[model samples]
Target: MTRSPIITVSRGRFSSTATQVLEQVRTARLASRDEIAAATGLSIATVGRTAALLVERGLLRERPDLARPGVTGRPGVPVEIDADGYLVIGVHIGRRIATVALGDLTGRVLASTTVRRPLGADPDLVQLSREAATLLGSCPGRVPLAAGLVAPWREIDLLPREREAELHDLTGLPARTGDHISAVAAAEFLHRRQGRSEAGGLTLYLYARDTFGWSVAVDRGVQTDVTRAASLTHFPTGADVPCSCGRTGCLAAAVDVLPDAARARILGATAGSVRDMLSPDQVVLVGQAFTGDPALRDVIVEAYAASTALADPVPVSFTRFGSDIQAISACTVALGPVLDDPLACVELTGVAAACRRPVA
Candidate 1:
């Protein structure tokens, strides 16, 4: 039961009105034209027109069976996400595991599989790509339109350009890659699905897997370009540990050797530093380190106290996921196109506007 990430683009190449309507329908899961109009504050006529256009774009589908009986000339048919029409392929390659899953337009997982790997070792791309192929081939309904590749920000630097180009060739679908933690943070900000509070201003997102990393989310999106000035990984942990980079001491190395309390304190210090420099409105904790262990939760709570002690305090909470959060984020990337928020596409608002015009 991997939970899908909720995604919302502020402005898409598609009709913002159409995007709004589709977002409403997705949020509601199912809705009639009247309901869409009410939710989006658009005219009923506008809803009908936008929805029809969305259907034409394959982002929506009409459900006549959901229409109520005893309606006048024609009851407005309820529409739901056409989950069966398009599929997203999500790939998350981590030090511990490599995963692949398929999702629909609404980001619902249809099927998934994973393979374990050596911790902190480079992934077997052939094996990972093979698994991804198998998953796509086995999906019962819907056609996969795109693929999303997710890994630690550091992994991006390690992958070769030739290997990167081959991914598109391997999948035969458009593909996207991004920082794993940032993807989750973006999803948290957009959908607020994990029961987290509304995101605004600077948000501190921290996580630990086989490695540790953090990102900043501002105004409902993760800022993927934080430098050493804003990164938590650069904080001094006051411990001399041998780092894999051949450095004498680094925060990443020290954390593994330190106790939970010490690690929390370091995290708190990092949070406090981030607050002083960035002034985030909230703190979001993700990854297995935060939620997988109750003791870590206590450590984080304690760390939160220490971090905010000297700076402006903000709300802090761990994101709870019903399924593998990373896999879902990866899937969200592929689902972006069908959801009308692809990472890249041409704007066609003028075309959409023309479609709304009545034929002579």
Candidate 2:
């Protein structure tokens, strides 16, 4: 068994053997005190006192069936975290809509609402942010401690920072956005969950809406915690299809379907689009393109096929969970914090060798 090494918890908040045990039992699901002590390299007495204090804080619990008699060769008790401790908000800002979901530490959606809005930071961006932020305004009697906002794919680099503070400030619930990709997180999380091991298959996620992103993960029979991926919307994939990015022939350059003019009318594109990118196997495609139109789905597949890089790998196909993947992806990112330990309850694992291949 791969023994999870005990590590320090809350570096400045509460640093001790107890805090370590608290974090582990709550997240890793270690069953007993001996298990905790062995993992921490701490003495049994310290483990006991620390556990007692945690029980008083409503942070830990002991299993009755696992409880043992006094030196009678009986089964011992197992302890775990009491999960009903806090609340968190997972906000997914999509091109056309924003989904806000309230969850516990275990990823349970206490309440959720999906709202649609215009795009960009001007009046639209401000409205989107204001509406997205309102989900937290109506607290569901739970602790309104933190909210995680997952903007559309390209905005990953737009999160305010030291220098970017001049860009704009996002307030309410210690929120900050960065280069964290939802496709990447979902892929890795799935690889760990279903594969039964650390390394196995690959996971490919394509956000196939107004704005798009792609991610791939591979495990050479070993589960991968890291991935090689990109959110590729910087330029047009084809030469003539219009895009929302205010350019022609960017991603809007090709058409296996209608004429570029016709596609532009339907796609509401800013550039001429062509089939440029291809996804690896078990590729999970999100958005209405797949569900609403069969021909559009075929076009997506064929467009992928036309590209040597995207078509050659022969990956399995997966679909997005909700209407907007960003919503669930946002859930995946934000919900992790609410649970005592997310891995125990949620099946965030995936198959082996997810997206590994020689890009054709």
Candidate 3:
């Protein structure tokens, strides 16, 4: 049993003990005070006090039947996330489309809307901010704790720091920004209510859409910082095609000549390069190419085989999320500060990999 450590919660916030206790309850789905104490290494009395505080905050609920008498013969009730009282908003900014969604405290998407906008081309931060605010306003859910915006790192980095404040002002809620790939990874890790993702150990994420890109994670956390200019758009693909970057035979340019299946294979091969560089335990392919097209999915598997021609090839899988992955993930990233404890939760899960922590 891993002993949960009491971590310092920031000032003017929930106490360290209460935060850790609530996290244990959320992670376990439901837990009695004794279970939380056992998992977190806090005293039963401490867990009881903290649980009381969490319950008062509407963050947790007590299960009367699960209650058992403690050493003093007082009933100890099990608690779980309230799930109905809190919400998060996520915005996914893509080259061809943008989306805004509302999610519950359990990370379930409750309402969402899609708008056609070329975010990758000429990004109008002001317009996009207004659109996101409007979309969020139209949705029905609990008031969101915060809103998260996700775009390609290249595109997001172009926005000045003041852009976050502008977004908040328009949306009337705190707002945060992150790379699309990292947002996808966070959604995969934090919102796995149905089943666990096959992504474990060092994992590689292959993304295909308006641009060719990828990101890496170990254990559920992104391996790179949001400020890192990571991209695979220009990697050579040995083709004679002209690229938008004025280069011939580039990966992004190969789309004109290669079939979807071939493109999937090339993506798999590119994933292999990451595997060689980091030796990940698994590779996950996300986006429309893998999930929407069956032929392309099979082709990507073949590509994975060809790419890992060497000994000890890593396994590969695909995300079950549909088109809304980016939007839902952005919400998770926005809620990351609360869901994913920087030092305590990471240390408990044993993933300690680094990325930009959420502000809210």
Candidate 4:
């Protein structure tokens, strides 16, 4: 909302040596400089310097307590994300409800609450901002760095720069907005990086609920440049349901086309068709359409399996976060700046003072 340089990192345009080191430590949860160097192809000296910078900025912590007992050097000391040092606010404006959450550096949700939205009403920035502030206030000692707002693309017109500015004005924090689908894809990307580096390939993320869309992540980054998810709402699903477009079988219209089993089959078949067209290396299913009912989920899975064209099955999985994906995705966007450039974020957000306060 403030158009700060730090907030623009959500656009997927920035990365640095510090980001590389921080990301390695985050992925491993704990890694020595040498381990980071090995994983990132950076020199040990570079890793040490970068790790030191990150530690000084409060994005990482030196874990001498976890050092190898018999070893006695910097390489013996591991560093991990300093999860307690700061917080970010995540606001997800959905069709019927808005969720506000406080998240730690490690993408853990600290606190969250939902505010219901009246049918067909525009989101109330003032109300959502108050909710976000309340969440942040609940965490006594935590310093909030930024806020991220996400909504359906159709809703994007309603949340122009003015809306973002309103949220920033109300909450006293820099705020940025992003497409909900892409944010969810980024969250999934971060989740995959937890224990190991993601294998190199294209990943297709399919989402459904009050809206329908898909997003793509190429290796480590979500494809933010592509913003055509809203167009998928009109994809033909071959069902005889009426659409606002004066056509039948549109994906959005097919959602309520018939019996639960038929709906599941149509959704699954639609997903498979998209997957085949993209030929992605993997597929991840998310949103209430996929998670709300077990029977529907099973039917969709069967239909998807039958629709694939490849001899070798592409790996398909459901989001582990389930209904919590919305909040987590928004948090991931808010955390983007820090993850992209830790030292810059500290300076930009004036978080340096908070970093100096001793941790309890």
Candidate 5:
């Protein structure tokens, strides 16, 4: 049976007090230092220090009204995660357009801008570099200090160290883009942000919008070898599907065949056609096609039924997410810095967790 993933983000593997505090804040939507201490067993001192640091990082905010009673202990300002204070930039690079988004730390997008740059003719890197720069430069929010980018990368036998550096440089945050922040090195970040352990299944995360991207997480954390388990761009229908690589029939090759393009106003036709093809149990369609267009939902439902007719049906139904598959895919690569195996993380974090989960 397939498994659908549930995402819950917390500072990974925190101490007992921190975990308790996080749960309170996540559920109650507001917390104060003393309140946190009273509710979670964290000492007021530790809570104060941690809360201060998180606030400095823009992860939380102070809520002054929910004051503590002074008779019992000291009164302190209330605190809540600054859901609106900071943002994560998600850039979806595709053959036809690019997507730039400003998301709060919780991964909720507050504002976004999409630019269409006909990319089939440009050198993929030069074009991608320009797009990444453009998105970071133009997106609107609280004047972001750091940018998180997602883009598709060219497939290779081996990737160079310089390529990694170039990606960081593209963000225009040169000093901040080094080892700790680069995609390949931040597995812990993505792993923690992705929150897939409880999903209990083997999954494939296809980052196929601006670029071909992916990540996989199973019941196990980083300790096992899920690399061998991921199928990259095409899983069940690899060479069999028509794709841009000039392959007669590749999984995404038929993306251009959607009939409802005009109605959906989606970037292109691939998404609609794919919807006509397979329907995983839980799909998380990102970008314009899925996010902005509603009729496309029907197209996806029909496509899903058609997908089942194949000789070997995908084992489970799926939820949906993806619009600029290529951009999401590329982000998967930029995302590689964080994973031991970038593709594996895609499987775990993306939709596969909702499709077929590994038995715990």
Candidate 6:
């Protein structure tokens, strides 16, 4: 089945009242409209209207059954995210494997399947889309609104937009594409937001594995414009390691940190450089380079501490997701539209035609 071209959701758009109410309800899991209004600093009337609209769109559901027994007003009824009502597809095209996953409205990965690709081969969009459709079919009652695709390496022959179009056409779902690193950062940010209150400031995310890269997140949003050339691969670490680009001491050349002190030093120096440049409130270390070996992680940490110029030390921590980072990041990209603008996403996905349809 053919699908309309998916319009890119503007990540730079300011949060709306509906978005605020939805986010408040999502974070609270279940909350009264009054609670949402209070948390979001929105008027009660605005919160009520936004909540009602979200409920109508199937993004949220009112739980009158859980209403306070003594209360006789709308304030007694609580609203919660309708996680089972919708699903989004997340496709991560890694260097060695391509993963397709199903995510709920709450960014939970419901199911996933991975396919291995030959070394340095272009991904088969048709095959990947078929796999995604199969996974979607396996979930009997969920309405899939959109798909998010992420890749570690960009193919010059096929742009990300073209790939998104192909996936959308094949799967009949709106699709968005982005760099895997940025998606990973976004996933981390969203995860932190969901878990606890985030400290106010910038977060610098460092990724090391087959490639070296970094992303910055301001408050609740991640910078999504990371390019391969802009990666930390070219960052000088003052090491003697040779890089494919005819450079010495490139970060990419130090990926093989199998207890090699030199490579570890390179990684540490790069992290320190990032620390000094951004002076982020927090630094998140992710990917196999840091998680694969404890010794390497220690070296990087030590180097980062020694390299920092700030009077106060910045907090540095490893990602809790570890190897599952890629999948979660892709899912975050898919759920972006719904979370950013639920009402618009519901309308764009034609929720009335499918979201409300009964499961067979």
Models 1 onward score TM values of: 0.74, 0.55, 0.77, 0.89, 0.50, 0.85
**Ten-residue segment with the worst summed lDDT in candidate 5?**
175-184
What ranking of all candidate models by lDDT puts the best one first? 4, 6, 1, 3, 2, 5
Clashes of each: 2, 69, 0, 1, 83, 0
RMSD of each: 6.9, 12.2, 8.7, 3.5, 12.0, 4.6
Report the Cα lDDT for residue 128, model 5: 52
State the local distance difference test value for candidate 2. 0.45
| lDDT for model 4 | 0.77
Assess the local accuracy of residue 174 in candidate 3 as a C-alpha lDDT between 0 and 100.
Answer: 55
Question: How large an RMSD does model 2 have?
Answer: 12.2
Best candidate, lDDT: 4
Rank order by TM-score, top first? 4, 6, 3, 1, 2, 5
Q: List pairs with backbone clashes in candidate 1.
A: 1-323, 2-323
Compared with the true structure, the alpha-carbon lDDT of candidate 6 equals 0.74
Q: Which scores better on lDDT, 1 or 6?
A: 6
Model with the higher lDDT, candidate 2 or 4? 4
Q: In candidate 1, residue 73 scores what lDDT?
A: 22
**Which regions of candidate 4 deviate over 4 angstroms?**
1-14, 220-230, 357-360
The prediction achieving the highest TM-score against the true structure is 4
| TM-score of candidate 4 versus the correct structure, residues matched by position | 0.89
lDDT on C-alpha atoms for all candidate structures: 0.62, 0.45, 0.61, 0.77, 0.39, 0.74
Residue pairs with backbone atoms closer than 3 Å in model 4 (clashes): 1-175
Per-residue lDDT value at 251 in model 1 = 68
Query: Candidate 1 residues 181-271, lDDT tens each?
Result: 7666655554563222223566667766555666665553211222111234545656677777777556677667777777666665655
